[model samples]
Target: MLKSEFAKTFAMLATGLSCVLMAQNTLADAPEHRIINLQAEATREVANDEMQATLYTELNEKDAATLANKINSIVNQAMNTAKSYPKVEIKTGGQNTYPVYNDKQQLVNWRGRAEVILNSQDFKQTSELIAKLQESMQLGNINFEVSAEQRNKVESELYIEASKAFQQRAKLLLAPWGASNYELVNLQLNANANRPMPIYAARDASFKADSIESQNIEAGNSEITVIANGSIQLK
Candidate 1:
């Protein structure tokens, strides 16, 4: 009787151990939580608040020293004139001098070109300055852009809108599956701006310095976009 009882107890313990091992294996084989990926974007058009203009001058001289002096003179005069408009930002741009080669590949004369760039939030001032500079320098191009501060503010607002849109889409997608809750697995945000091409026009060197007119510029719209990408695990 003692031996029979001991055998029965051992059999019960073995059965319990086997059941525990099977439960563990089942848990291990079960698939991980499922997730759905989603993306949403928002765009806003805002008026450009900044202006940039590039003006350049070219000179051809038989002597290199004379060419450099002339270029420096013109650039200095332009810089001084720009200082009068305290609101405008001025900076010197590319200055290049290269030797002109004849058919025989011998260096003949030297040609030099210098550029000055101006930027400002005040469109009127910037345009007028460019017109004045045309007396000595040629107009390269004019560009309009949205200021950094304004762009940042607009992007911040769009980010919120895009995130909300993403969440709404996720909920709508999961509604049919009878899943009303989700866990955000990962998310990403991106911001971008669409800048228009620079405006080009014929050099207005014909206009007299005294009669130079201030240009009336229209600040076009810049389209700012923000996108949100994320994966959510439905609960």
Candidate 2:
């Protein structure tokens, strides 16, 4: 009888210890009904401070080398012309050469295109360079965006504002719940740009190199929004 009683007591103690460890692990995360979701956002419209444009010269020839040479010559001239605009940055974009197929499926000739890209903060200078280059190469596309420096500055400011707003809202909500304080269980910060996209009449026959003139451009605006989304546990 003594041996049986001792065995039963040890079994009970071991079972209790296992249950305690399991309960502790289960409660490691926040308890039910203790978590609350909150979200705050701040937004600002900033003028687009940068521009990028692509120009390309396409040609066809009996030989691939001849086509490439013609395309390269036109692009080199375009880059050289862009050098006149000190504020604009000019770089080679891409060059592609492919075989041209005839009605008989014969690879009769080679078609190629050499491209150049222009980047600048000065819209006037960029437009002028585009007009000059358009005299040779055709305009491909144009895009406007906020510069990196300005974007970073605006996003930093908005993050602080959004975080503070989130904290304030949390405190206000807790006051109604009769809770003295709350814990920040999780937080997520995000930013997105809502801006109008620039449209261009690229590759249109009406926009031929000989008929095109200086382009009118607008910098427009981009809305930079920062959102603070998170959940907090009531204390």
Best by lDDT: 1
Give me the displacement of residue 216 in model 2, in angstroms. Answer: 4.2
lDDT of 1: 0.89
In model 2, what lDDT does residue 179 have?
Answer: 81
Deviation (Å) of 83 in candidate 2: 1.2
Candidate 1 backbone overlaps, count: 0
Question: What's model 2's overall lDDT?
Answer: 0.85
lDDT (tens digit, per residue) of candidate 2 on 103-216: 999999998988898899988778777777777778888889999999999999999999999999999988778788999989999998886676564466244444345345
Best by TM-score: 1
Predicted candidate 1 versus true structure: per-residue lDDT over 77-152, tens digit per residue: 9999998798899999999999999999999999999999999998877877887888899988888999999998
Tell me the whole-model lDDT of each prediction, alpha carbons only.
Answer: 0.89, 0.85
